[model samples]
Target: MGESVAGRLFSVLDAFEDGGPAALRLTDIAARTGLPAPTALRLVRELVAWGGLERGADGRYRLGLRLRMLGAAAPCPRGLLDAALPELRALAARTGGHADLAVRTAPSADGILCLVSGDRLPPHATAYGKVLLAVPPAVLPRHTRHTVGSPGVLARQLAGIRTAGLAVCAEEFRLGEVSVAAPVRGPAGTLAALGVTVPTGVPLDRVTAAVRAAAARVRPPEPPPYPSP
Candidate 1:
């Protein structure tokens, strides 16, 4: 049987991946999608018309901003980022650091997906990742020289974080970077985390307080209970 149009379309989009080039030539897209040049051209033009893809000035194709808008509309348990943004902004303002919101997208995935971030930090080496990883040990791929590679040690560290109600990391993801994070709870459980990253020398006590306060301010909506039998 022939591949469905939808399947081919998805394959074309999936050809793009993180760390790959920002744009792909027509032949590159064709080869990546395993579609003949003619078919790929037809679909690429359609996608461009639909705003799912864009043709750059250089004549290469890239995923369009519309896709990002569409992806943001996808379901989240409790509108997590919307509820947390205010607090996140406050945290960044107070600490003058990178503030981020992260959530566990899947139990099997090794790391949390950042929903909103004020600055970039390696997920495995930051306080936000630690808070998200504390409950269930989804060991992350190492990204830095100081990244914790051992699950056993990470688990123990997470235990301490659970007790302290916050997580802190110093230069673990990148040299001279320090971060602190606290959990935002929902009716179901921990729905997301709030994090702030700063210079290594900044006093953590104030940052930790701000993070905790910000996390407390975000109240993820309660999930509707199951109907009683």
Candidate 2:
């Protein structure tokens, strides 16, 4: 390519975009982008000065507010969140539990993507976060002893979600907490997830079925894509 420096700088930014730490040290950025030490240091300094990244007190770098400001102005489907919010709220209200509509992010290695917290938020110890599967579990320091950490365990849970159209966690992710999640579809014909969380001892299957029905009610409007001619 023409300008290796520019490519490297963009790569550094891309590293952050792909779930790099909120703050990355010179070594951290180097490791994330596979850049040599000297190059990482120079690019990070430039990015920090340019307001694309910031060096924090601990000497780690993070995405700066300027990037976030610019990102927010980008266009996205307006109905994306609108279509999910009402049903999320209703689920929360009926279950007396937290509800979420989550989208999987393209960047992270995590099995799931993100959750839109609707009603009450589940305790950090619960699997609502796991069901949503946004950031890789490693990204967030372990918050609870009950958290299901292994990739194998999480894979199994996601399998269950695919088969049953929902996932349930009973005090496995948190103490005295339970969460159930169902998949939701979008206008673009993609599936997101809806979750409800409550204290342990609630009947999780009932909540799961209710959410599954709610997901069925909100059909995605996009026509299926035609195969190649």
Candidate 3:
């Protein structure tokens, strides 16, 4: 049996679930999604026409604003995001603030893999991934020359993240991009992460403060007391 048309189209978008948060070439998409090159190109063209994908000047493709909006509406198994979207939006509206909520984080197959959209960035190289990842890896994947691949160094970073309740990555995954993230936890522990990506020298002190505030606001409201038996 062959894959459904909708599944094929979804596969193209799913291909970007990991790796650096960088625009992907058609070849990269094809290889990642396990689709043929021509097939990937055809699907990408349809997505671009339908506004589900955006192609940049460099001819790389990324999820379009429309697609992202739809993603925001998808069912959240934990219902945590229902309390977060508003705060995330407010944070994003500020100058240079790219706000996000952790979609999910995969098992530690490769020593703590971060999963899609927000999980697209490398855990060792981005603030969002770093905070969500509980254990530091023995060997970190290097996304750039500046990436912190040293396990010892990364352990210290993780320790700081736990202590400060935040993480900050400075051009570790890609030059000119900085990320700050904080964990959103409930009684069960981190339900998700909230973060912002901004450029260098953008007053990180202020951005970090804003992100922390937004994360705080995303806490699920207290449940009403049960009726007296």
* lDDT of every model, 2 decimals: 0.75, 0.61, 0.74
| Model 1 lDDT tens row, 1-229 | 9999999998888776433354789999998889999999999998999988889899999777566455445567337778888888888999999788876544544445566632323445778877877443444556667778777788788889888889998878788998789989877677777888799899988998899999988888655578999
Kindly list the per-residue Cα lDDT of model 3 for residues 1-229, writing each as its tens digit: 9998899998987776554344689989988889989999999999999998899999999777676555555554235566777887789887466777764433432212222242345567888778877776555768778899788888888889999999999989888888888988888677567888888778887898998998888866555578999
Candidate number achieving the greatest lDDT relative to the actual structure? 1
Which ranges of candidate 2 are over 4 A from the true structure?
1-9, 16-24, 34-78, 111-143, 186-190, 221-229
Q: What tens-digit string does per-residue lDDT give for candidate 2 at 75-193?
A: 33224445666787888888888776555433352323233532222222344444455323543334466666565666666566556666677776567887776666555444566
Ranked candidates (lDDT, high to low): 1, 3, 2
Per-residue lDDT of 140 in model 2: 39
Candidate ranking (TM-score, best to worst): 1, 2, 3
Which candidate tops TM-score? 1
lDDT of 2: 0.61
